[model samples]
Target: MPGTPGKGEEMASDLSQSLPKRTFKYQSSLPPLPVPSLENSLSKYLEAVRPFASEDEFKATVQIVRKFQDGVGKVLHYKLLQRAKTKKNWLEEWWFDTAYLEVRIPSQLNVNFGGPGPYLEHCWPPAEGTCLERASLLIWHTLQYWNLLLTERLAPQKAGKTPLDMDQFRMLFCTCKVPGVMKDTIHNYFKTEREGPCPSHLAVMCHGRIFTFDALCDGEILTPPELLRQLRFVKDRCEGEPEGDGVAALTSEERTRWAKAREHLINIDPHNKTILETIQSSLFIISLDETKPYSTPENYTNMTLEALTGNPTLRWGDKSYNLLVFSDGTFGSNCDHAPYDAMVLVSMCWYVDQQLRLTDGKWKSTLMQTVIDCGNVHFVR
Candidate 1:
């Protein structure tokens, strides 16, 4: 399983009834990443090195390049071809470890990428005092997106008819990066409807406390009002209680240090291990921060700053995605770069922003009524 790309969650073909298996079927049929020829590789390497070297240094580098290309480089290239004979993507494992997991630094602002929620422009932002409400509404939309993946309704992404790798989309939910003494590992708990039962719970972090509840009730996705109730309960529960131990901040520490801390935490208390799994297995984390980091169309500096680097203790930085809900009803996200690239988040943001514009930050689906006691609020925007 080490070199395998997709989490061995592929659907079986012996089923009696046909189902939507396009997501994986196409991926399986598509070509594996091709290995470039040695000449191209060394030529590009020399081109890259040329810009950083002076005339004499460049000449020396060229001589070294030629000697290596004709000598050791050729041998290495032969070995690479032998390795490729057994594996389709020979570069995946090494590239993954070298580029991400083997790095020891804290992931926050260094390796992770985040920014202000661009959905705030053009009357698209939520009003004041509706942070929880707006968050619930946003969660509902996000769940819908998850359902798209589950049902295989989401079309495969492409670059001018050439399909792009859709593996990262699997990491969008129910995924967390687990730290180790030497390297980190990604744990993805998501399962498509065809793959069988998966975690439907949602985790909320507030006041340095973590809380989780099922995002689905009676086998149906929770309505906006229902989600609002859960969010409100988390808010009320954290308000009067003493602050929690803030274990999440440990995820913001160096990888090796965090790994040791996690080990000690589990060793001291069996319950601590369960708590960690509950979070890692959930859909994702929703962070309720007290600061507004107020933003406007002209200036998103404060919000962007808060989202990328604010409140080290408030978020589980290793989670695949952390939806940051500010006190003033705006939004942003911080995510682990282990399982996916930033473009996936950008595409999701674009989809949700367009969907929000269509519905005005609310849903037009069923279970729309004044249910919660919060002044008989109507869910219909």
Candidate 2:
């Protein structure tokens, strides 16, 4: 019985045996997604002529030509005329005499200079700095350059010409206010004071009120009258310290004193007077259509002028726009062609910053977003 095992024991021993196991492997095969080309995304029409390096040269040549045409069209057609028509009230230290000349605003001003698209303009040199600041600087520089050309041509130095004084300068800005509008807070100040309100507004108005600085200048001498140079000189003297008869312009300190002595215009804020208002009023909106070639920037300038000074019937649609402004917070029969240039607008913005500093009695800061809403063209000094 010990030597012989039971049938159940035998079967149990056989069942305890191990069996072979089969294995299956997984093969990884798929690759990663490709990144899209940035150039291709930015310009859908940009074609790749070759995988070779020479392909770049051909593309550059074509683009440069296109850029040249765009720049020429913009500057000749719109930019130059806009510069001629849209004057800025220059600050005291920066003011230039334009009257000693005869500068004419041609019915149609044209130029052949070429470079780049308006948007790409600031990028050409790449030395102009970042996009935001460069954009502002570009606009500022372009206008300045054009103004200098016009001034040199129309108001050149002549023999036996007397420079202008303050009273004459201030008179240039006394254009009728736009009808039906409330009196500007700054204007109220000028009404009470003998000297005037703000220099910046006065400056801008002086610049835009005149017909043409170019019409008056020729070669080394200006036209016989010399009213143009005299007027602009008066503007500068008013902004700075003018020394002469009572005919001379008021200095910054003198103006400040007058502003302080004056009640209606003087406020807790120093920049709140007409001087600051002059700068604020010169902001303009220049319209541009990028659709057609040879459609010069001047075309747009003409369009803007028409909107401002042309017939009511013509002042409608896309053409009906405003490029020049001399807002005094008032509206009367004479609103359309009030004075004030773009530089004056820049000065006004700076003046606001100065006022905030003086009023708050601290380092003043501006919330440009707030400015966009509360202190744009409508926010008079």
Candidate 3:
């Protein structure tokens, strides 16, 4: 398969489009997480294990815990204190590695978190014949949110007067994880206006195929009409060709296996390496799903399940976020667990949902509050 596009090839490429790269960034403020005292931790552990322990087991555990608390635990606790003195957040790195990057399992089934957009069904229900239109609209709104952060126009989130950490927001876009044999590493391409350029491109997948274009043109975000044209081009291209090689499925493989496969793929063709980097550095993905996952205002299980477990070929499991746009006019997201805080994703979803509610679920022009009516549906160009 060297120098030839055939079996085991990286199917994500071949449209052969290119664009100028752009940059992005954000701000954050949060205190270090407090470490619990050893006595408090030990008592909680004992409480949790009581159900599994009989009277004798419980008594023996108490004796062992008392001895360890005075002996090994004291020394370990001192080490933890030393670690805390050296690191602002002693547990952060350990949690990241143990909970996600170091796990060798398939990320799709184990690490990624997928769910329906917050209250999305209310504004954009599962209506037929509205996939592409609504998708373009949604993408435009998402870019607007990204723009807020990029321009530093959005205020730092706060709880009362204290600023909550907004670090995860920056990682929500233009971020990805590269697989390693023992540990995966996050490649965040976002940079502050002062830090210089970050990627402004967007990658979209249709029928297991990927096509990318810069989300911004001439230092400005693309309008919804422009995005629709680009999406339509990808869809049309897919219709004319056979099913793609579905190489993205490899991302769902065991981390070590995926790392090895990726290495072989790159060695087979240098272009394969470029395509992989393009995907990793681009803004999060948009998956154009053909399946109609029925969902409504109250329940999003169908949509959520499909987003989490649908076509592995359509999802780049290591990306920080993969927006799933179903043919039934529903939307959900599959996000990596690295910058895996829920509130970061939730705040953006919540913002877009509110925007939709304000406009009564109609697509509106960026310059005005109203939309141009066309064929019983409102549109913005």
Instruction: Give the winner by TM-score.
Output: 1
List, in order, the clash count of every candidate structure. Answer: 0, 46, 3
lDDT of 2: 0.24
lDDT of 2 by residue, 1-381 (tens): 111222112111111223121000011221222333333432433343334437677677558645754676444545534543444321221221121011112101110011222222112222211322322222232222222222221122123542222111121222222111111111211111222322112121221121112211222112112322333343453346432221101111122232333333436556645533333233221211111122133343432333234322111111101222111110101121123333333332333233223323121123121211111112122
C-alpha lDDT values of all predictions = 0.78, 0.24, 0.75
- 1-381 per-residue lDDT for model 3 (tens digits): 011222112211211113122221213234566778999999998998899999999999999999999999999999998898878789989998998889999988887898887545566767888878888777877877676556444566667866666677789889999999899998999765555787888888877778888776555566567677777778788899888877888989999999999999989988888889889998889898888888876777888889889998889999998998888888889988887587788878877776667666665554532222221211110
If the candidates were sorted by their TM-score against the true structure, best first, what order would they fall in? 1, 3, 2
Model 3 stretches astray by more than 4 angstroms: 1-30, 118-120, 366-381
* C-alpha RMSD by candidate, in order: 7.4, 33.7, 10.4
List of clashing residue pairs for candidate 1:
none
Between prediction 1 and prediction 3, the one with superior lDDT is 1
Ten residues in sequence with the least summed lDDT for candidate 3: 372-381
Off by over 4 Å in 2: 1-135, 138-160, 164-176, 180-294, 297-381
TM-score of model 1 (CA atoms): 0.89
Q: Which candidate is the best by lDDT?
A: 1
TM-score winner between 2 and 3, please give it: 3
Q: What C-alpha lDDT does candidate 1 achieve relative to the native structure?
A: 0.78
Residue 16 CA error for candidate 1 (Å)? Answer: 24
Error of 2 at 34 (Å): 83
Task: Give the TM-score of each candidate.
Answer: 0.89, 0.20, 0.86
